[model samples]
Target: MTGLPMEFRAEGLPDRVTIYEVGPRDGLQNEKTVVPVETKALLVSRLAAAGLTAVESTSFVHPTWVPQLADAEDLLTRLDRAPGVRYPVLVPNERGLDRAMAHGVTEIAIFGSATETFARRNLNRSLDASIEMFTPVVTRATEAGIRVRAYLSMCFGDPWEGPVPVEQVVRTGVRLLDLGCAELSLGDTIGAGTPGHVTTLLTGFAAAGVGPERLAVHFHDTYGQALVNTLAALRAGVTVVDASAGGIGGCPYARSATGNLATEDLVWMLNGLGIATGVDLGALVTTSVWLAGELGRPSPSRVVQALSKEQEPDHAQA
Candidate 1:
């Protein structure tokens, strides 16, 4: 009960797993310093070269809210988009979707919280009202032939509401799926979840006829349990995971929440488990090192730190 109920091992597992790269969007969004537009584009291009199939390029939210991503339009417009990959942007409303469409976005993501308290605290609306507002956004995006992914935030727990109800999470997820969401990302916004909690939730979804294939896991590393929960999910048949590079971002309103699991850390685990991520770990580490330097802090990834130490020469030997 303290951690994973049982120690799980990933041996002879599937050769490949899909990683939804959210560095360019989620990682950079919470950066205190505003990353230059050119730098943002470079990050996306590098991620593409590193073999990520889905790169969340940016959020189309208002600049007044997230000034770090104020250049979303510019970055999207100037990207040297890679073939055979999808770049999706976070669109909170019709205006955000319109802006994304103008930039030639082929895929967009709409997000809502599972609990009314979380919705009101983060978006200033009730849970029912928030869903009502996004129905049209999803409808128009579908009509325009753009794939939409729905994000169900605080599925695990919330800062204001505390432990979110499974029924509430299911209700919201069903609505989004009914609205034609290609996939639903269940977010542990506060990083207060454990493997047992995750299994309970996934089991509930499965019993409700929602398989793991249609679901993605988005975990924060607030308590360093993201990877632990991920291992649990994979054993349960989930293949898609959302991670950020350098462990760089968290929700502004979710107190005490850290960033998403580091891409390098997740990749290391997946690769070790024989999961095919198609990502280059060396390149990912390099990118994490560069971004951590830019952020003026050491990376939050334990794997990166260990790797860095191993590569360093023992000057004390002299």
Candidate 2:
């Protein structure tokens, strides 16, 4: 591990940041190639070994919508759930939640959109109707002693709707919270967010009584601003950030959107800033390299690339 610069050490950042690893679930869901259930289980184990306390294992959405994760039940059943580790899965509706419950799932996530077009296109319903749909799911899960994390996607910009208003994001987020979600993850699904936009939205969240403690920021690297936006969120007192190993997954609905913020990249920044994430940067880079090979591609993470290069034996010196 590297030491933090003196200047950054005094930046008043959180002493520890919670990295919610989404590699096995969100990261693999958009892959054109089919990933075996065993590989997904191994990915979850590797993430836990790398000190990721929270790993999203899979989603229970209908296979028709996300064929890649059709093996959600098999993957979850085969996962090696480590002590003190969480493997939350995405439950799209009542049916998904029931399937997750049948497998003894303790944590689950539900997703909504900040824009009407995205809501209709993604969930086949209007913004208000989608929230109503989630009400039963969230209520039932909470009653079952399951923790729920709600994701509000396209919080910054929508592919069809253009820029989304900050107020609308706040209002939707508040509604999700009211429906019994334990935490809300604001997503930059299109990666259209800048540091200024992040700051402004978080400010609105603060005014709406949604403090940083109950919020997580999920950003994509479509525009290469994910890390900058993450930094801005961190500085604003947000501690939980969502990332994918190897930068593998993207929104299948948003054609222009690319891979998510890489776990290795986020750890590099947090580690350098003296923020404890309990993750081993070298181990995480190695995981991404392995996963990239499985997907027959190179990792999109800049940190992973740099670290892999550094680890290569120097034939010139030899």
Candidate 3:
């Protein structure tokens, strides 16, 4: 919440909007190099320290699909769990859920794309079939008293099948809701959505009785509209947002996709708007820089890049 006044408050907005930091898992999943387990653990710990209420710590998917997350178990075991912060892992199936459960994971996220083409391409299942699979996972998780977050991919448009209809998105979301998902994250998988699309889709969902509290937004920056879209969601009464540190992450199935919305940028916008996300931008920058060092690459977060340059000492001083 850096850059925000102590008494800062957005009029007519909720007391705070919960930011779901997906850096540890979504951000690292698409990396070519394998981030050390220590680095991943440190990222999760740092995110919690920065005051993110919900940090997506890791994914329990097969290592073959996302090699960068091969050390998920190790990373999860090492993150320092804060008392009030939640750590959720993405689990694709029962086996993944089992692995996550064994580590005492209290929250898990299941994903299903809105379009059949994207589903078959990304998840290897039909849209209906994928939604059905989550039913059992949701049932078991509920019985175990674990909260589940379900992701609906390509809610606006898919690379394979363009322009996903509002009806399809609503159907998939309703299915996840029926399966007992605590939240349905609507993802613009390829960054093809605009503010208008967000309004339309959110309105459709609201009409279907899936109110703002039960939804989250996951947007990419490919078209440079993530922030604006986020603002739209906020106006529509949506509270939770999914972002990646340094804007890391991409859809592996969509090779041309850009990074997920940068967490620093999102924090900057929220702080300026007097919306409490509870994230410390300076600490977020440090963590992103650490991650960049681990990957041997520069961060994509504009705020991080600018702030890093500002913080560097003058060459003459050296």
**Each candidate: what lDDT?**
0.86, 0.91, 0.88
Residue lDDT tens for model 2, 1-318: 242223256375798999999888888989998898888889899999999999999999999999999999998879888999998999989999989999999999999999999999999999999999999999999998999999999999998989899999999999999998899999999999999999999999999998999999999999899999999999999999999987888898899889999998888788778788999877888888998888889998888888898888999999
- For candidate 1, report its TM-score: 0.94
lDDT score of residue 294 within candidate 3 = 85
State candidate 3's TM-score: 0.95
lDDT of 1 by residue, 83-184 (tens): 989999999889998898888899999889999888897778998888888988999999999999999999999887788988889888988888888999
Q: How many steric clashes between backbone atoms does each model show?
A: 3, 0, 1
- TM-scores, each model vs. reference: 0.94, 0.97, 0.95
Sort by lDDT, best first: 2, 3, 1
Choose the strongest candidate by TM-score: 2
Given candidate 3, what's the lDDT at residue 99?
Answer: 95
Clashing pairs in 3: 1-279
Tell me the lDDT of model 1 at 239.
86
lDDT of the structure predicted as candidate 3? 0.88
Task: Estimate candidate 3's RMSD in Å.
Answer: 2.1
The true-versus-predicted C-alpha distance at residue 207 of model 1, in Å, is 1.6
Residue by residue across 16-103, what tens digits does model 3's lDDT show?
7888999888988988888889878888888888888899988988989999898888887788899999999999999899999999
Q: Candidate 2: minimum summed lDDT over ten consecutive residues — where?
A: 1-10
Candidate 3 has its poorest 10 consecutive residues by lDDT at 1-10
